[model samples]
Target chain A: MTAEYFMVLGLLGVAFFSVAGALLGYEKSISGFGVVVVATVTALGGGTLRDILLDKPIFWIATPEYLYSTYAAIIATIFFVRYLPHVNNYYFLLVDAIGMALFNIMGIEKALISGTGMVIAITMGITTGIFGGLIRDVICREVPSVMRNEPYASACLAGGLVYAALFTIEVDYIWCILGSLFTTVFLRLGSLHWGWHLTIFRKKDFKNQSD
Target chain B: MTAEYFMVLGLLGVAFFSVAGALLGYEKSISGFGVVVVATVTALGGGTLRDILLDKPIFWIATPEYLYSTYAAIIATIFFVRYLPHVNNYYFLLVDAIGMALFNIMGIEKALISGTGMVIAITMGITTGIFGGLIRDVICREVPSVMRNEPYASACLAGGLVYAALFTIEVDYIWCILGSLFTTVFLRLGSLHWGWHLTIFRKKDFKNQSD
Candidate 1:
């Protein structure tokens, strides 16, 4: 039952990720083919990377339905996303947060089930949630917002911790999933609204010392 | 005997790749720790991505010696690369060509070994040859030289086809490796010397055309 639930949410997240990627392409005014390609990569890249790192068969290979879903999302985006006259930040944030949140929870669960430690699970969850977008941003020749100023991975870390804690006590699986999902989504939304940001590291410039 | 030879060359290529990445970090004037991180990622990212896509155990995981090798390369780079005053274009090009050429051959060979088709072998070869540098370029916020020009991926494609054809004809494995490596390295150097470039795809802008 729990596995089925995770599968459904994971699939849904892929659809959201595909649409979000397509939206980025549209915002950048790329070609239609580029849109589809970017969408497909965004939807599958994170989960594929996570699975590969874990030495497991990719989730999409096990169920080709995921590929079909990504295609379907691309088609949907061509009609809807491509026609938008102006960027809709709210819709993008909501969809992106939800999708990444689902992926975060799924990645952590996969790691824990594979007997990985809690810290590793959280790190993997963050990687799954944000790495695809980082790749997308890099491809577009823009600095990744997640890397510079956003609580995106921070939200994933918090939600992953919540999920792991719940699982540790043998709490109900349904609540564990839902609770973590809610935490990430809300955390992201709150950060977006309040302008919360991650502090970045920078090397001290010694040239200034002489002055 | 052939497999073992390829293994040694591929390992040597990884060492070179790691050093080349570290050289890039130094050229960019990043901190020491940041240099090592960037170098490690650039060295391993492509092979890691290839292994994951092929659903094989990551080479570094199977042989932790690769990690130690990366560390050694980092130490070497800190001493050698940091002292270089100007853009050592010759050294960079030579090392990069050798490393990427070897990776191109290995990726194709691994694909063929896994019972994959010819097209996939070529694609994987290109991916393995260029994707690590792609990751490096992205992190450094530069346009990927491969995507833009200089016959980067083109050389890999040519070399991969040569290797595959030679393998198909049951040629001596040593000759196949040397022939392809020479082909890629020469192709890149020729392009560099002659200012050869790849044509990029761009949609015609109607507004610009009218203006």
Candidate 2:
């Protein structure tokens, strides 16, 4: 509704994703400190990349509140998941979709305001939405879901394209933001519900080699 | 050596890592274009992070030659590795060590010149050295070697500390660079030769959870 409102939602998104990240690290048998590190990376990694590419100060470094929120969420989730068992499993997709939608739209807005072209703006949006999970998966020694046949980055890309197109057509900023966020969340949730996936292609003669 | 000499060596280091990245992507059966992307990420990912954290213009975007070098090296490696299967395997560690040493020292020098304190400078140096490989490994669905028991980041840390300590003691700039480079390369190569590795630790009661 308002910039301030969006900011608060964005921080909530960061916290939700931190829970996912911490749970992931817990699965890997990481230590307490290590789980915190992994969760922080998962929460802030995408925004950090977007800001860096835009040559802006890193978002978390510029706003300590995001870091604080991430830690707070991580602590809460650790206890909740530890006691509840299966809570994280049930809510992972919902949290992931909400976080992706919030971060993706915010990234597009930041890139547009920075005067980048629509394509770069959209690219930045997708980067901000997906890279945090990608980095977390890497650290936890898993292939990123985005790289699989899942509709992860594709959902971000669709949302980014929608936002850019709406902005280009002189849509109001609020409507543009809302439109994009809805697109991302809807697509992500729908895909998960229906088991929709992207297709993978490879060369006919390509041989898999273990290096 | 001269600054110009180090600059040339740095570009070569980028090229070497590009080859390693391309080879890894090839092992994963990535498409031709995907290999190029992965290789470029592996080569430039660290320096990009360094420049961003330092709030400076991205080095590759500022100097397009680095991008050109990455592309050229990726193409070369693709052709080279396709025909010569064992080549990448034999040369991977050497190329990685050289690249790490060059990038690590350059990062330290850049941070010091940027007026950052010694600790930040050293941290930036390690970030520049290892983040590229870390990102690359993540994209390729492998756990980063640095996050494992490997001495990868530890070598960078050791080198960064050496450089900062030398510079603090009023060592000549050239000597500082040389000292750090030698330290990194020696430790990395020696670790491989002697099978030395960092230790992993976890809580006694930590139970592995599958998420």
The top-ranked prediction according to DockQ is 2
How many angstroms is the interface RMSD of candidate 2?
Answer: 5.3
Q: Candidate 1 on B1-211: residue-level lDDT in tens?
A: 2667766876887888998887788677787588888888888887887887888788889878778887897788788754666656677777888889888888887877877767667767877888788788878877665535468877888898898788789899887888889999888888888886553222234334445
Work out the iRMS of candidate 1. Answer: 6.0
* Pairs of residues clashing in candidate 1: none
Instruction: Evaluate residue A69 in candidate 2 and report its C-alpha lDDT on the 0 to 100 scale.
Output: 92
lDDT tens digits, residue span B103-179, model 2: 89878877877899888988998999999998787687677888676688889999988887887798777888788
Could you give me the TM-score of model 2 versus the true structure?
0.61
Q: What CA RMSD would candidate 1 show?
A: 7.3
lDDT (0 to 1) per candidate: 0.78, 0.78
For every candidate, the chain B TM-score is 0.90, 0.88
- In model 2, pairs of residues that clash are none
Those runs of model 2 whose alpha carbons end farther than 4 Å from true positions after fitting are A22-40, A52-90, A117-120, A138-141, A186-205, A208-211, B1-23, B30-40, B52-55, B60-130, B138-211
Q: Give the docking tier of candidate 2.
A: incorrect
Candidate 2, residues A86-169, lDDT tens digits: the string is: 565447778878888888887887777777666667767877888888778777878666655557777888898888788889
